[model samples]
Target: MPEPHQLAADADRAAVVTRLDESLADGRLTLAEYEDRSTRAHGARTYGELAELTTDLPRPAAPATPAAPGPSPVARAVYGGAWHGAWGNDLRAAWTSWLVTGVIVTGIWLVSMLGSGDLVYPWPVWVVGPWGVVLLARTLGERRSRGDRQLPA
Candidate 1:
């Protein structure tokens, strides 16, 4: 732990100010006292100086732990996969765009082939294959991060 005699950073001063503001909001300090404490907090050079501003106020409560999340029903209905939530929505959009682009490029390739009367290289594969692979990798990575072994029904 840093000693109170240590120099205070801007963040330290800001924290003290926040405490003072809370104290004022809760009627622990009058407006004049809050202003005085706030000015002193901002001007404080050492941690001890900042600490003196909030010595009487209680500590802020610790944040409660979040509950385990279930799959989002709307996302599930629209996306049709085990994936749900923000990451899942993003992946679904990416995959949808990739699929649409693949279809368009493949159609263009088919038209060119008909006009030339020769089956040349499918250049669209070069465009879409690597993109699809990257998206697949991202999807798998998201699943791994969530500790999911199999896709949901």
Candidate 2:
């Protein structure tokens, strides 16, 4: 698993940008400086990079304790903890359901096709397609909402 500090997400960038905006409004930074730092903050790919953008200003969020830089095998060995953390908190459940539903539906479809000795209309698609579309929409909506919230990194 990647170290916690190794990557920054959209929410992190948004938070730094908010802090930069605050600084600009309060006369701590000029327009050009704010613009430059805002761009850099959005582009930052790690916590350290984001932290640097607001180092001179009052923190907009809790101080990001630099997560341990090394990939700690011990940290990852903690079963559900690292597994959930590996792909953000929500991915494990979504991915697990995707896999399980796919396999079960495929299995049932195969049995139906073989039992009738014919591949007529692929009916399993009815179940799988709608489920997949709904899941995709939910995933995308969650990301969009999270980006909008930008509560913290």
Candidate 3:
């Protein structure tokens, strides 16, 4: 480890500022104290100076067990582990839009059919189907890529 007197980088100062912010949020520091510490943190020139600003704060607790190296529980439960991380979040939003669009289009089709007093060919399927296929393909591709990264047991 570098000596405490070593020059602090901007990231080092920023990290101390973040800790001070957390302390303020948790009510460990009054606004006045937080402002003082935050200003000091930003102006700190060495590791020792930065460290002094947060020495009174408790350290973050370590997880009891190492976090499982995989997708989050919500993703696993909802997506069967095919979707995760940032890309998975994007996939979820896309699917949500698709579902909403499908519902709206299907509703319009139903209303039009009722007005005509005759069965009309369902056209909403054309709007929903191809988009669904593409989303499914992307999901499967994500799953396959995740599988590829696993070590053989």
Candidate 4:
């Protein structure tokens, strides 16, 4: 498990982002305003502050998809929970699917770049998304192999 500080930070980020989403949906904030706020929200320092910001915000739709397999740590971490409730497993499956997809996407991007074409993704997306996939793949695999001992059967 990661340090509590990091988990708290991730939760804070998720909350702040949700607040940004609510602000964008309401006419009280414009796209540009939302963008500016989003930039700041991503840099938020504490869950307390994020809780404050989202106090008046409408509830956001959960990113969890319970019909699937367990959620990867990235899913849990990004979605502001230890596990994504019933959908955690499904989200983990989705992450695995994305990992395979990311490899294909990167391969195509590489081929395109080699042929004097452009990558479908920005350089950072290729780097970050795949790294996340790989990390989550390992994390979820470890969790799954540990069996229902840790998670609900």
lDDT winner among the candidates?
A: 3
lDDT of each: 0.81, 0.71, 0.83, 0.61
Tens-digit lDDT string for candidate 4 (1-153): 333344346766775777677677777678987786677677767555455555666666679766745545664558433334343344445566677877777776788787876545446476557678666766665556555555323
The collision pairs in model 1 are none
Off by over 4 Å in 4: 1-7, 25-28, 61-153
Candidate 3 lowest-lDDT run of ten: 144-153
Residue 34 lDDT in candidate 3: 94
Q: What lDDT score is found at residue 120 in candidate 3?
A: 99
lDDT tens digits, residue span 1-153, model 2: 235478988988897898888899999999999999999987889988887787889756576688544324543354212322324555547667877888898898899889999986777688678877876776665555544332222
Q: Please provide, for model 1 over 58-90, each residue's C-alpha lDDT reduced to its tens digit, 9 standing for 90 to 100.
A: 989999998756556776566444454344366
Per-prediction TM-score to the true structure, in the order listed: 0.55, 0.36, 0.48, 0.29
In terms of lDDT, which candidate is stronger, 2 or 4? Answer: 2
RMSD of 3: 8.7
Note the residue pairs that clash in candidate 2: none
- On the 0 to 100 scale, the lDDT of residue 2 in model 3 is 60
Clashing pairs in 3: none
Q: Which candidate would rank higher by TM-score, 2 or 4?
A: 2
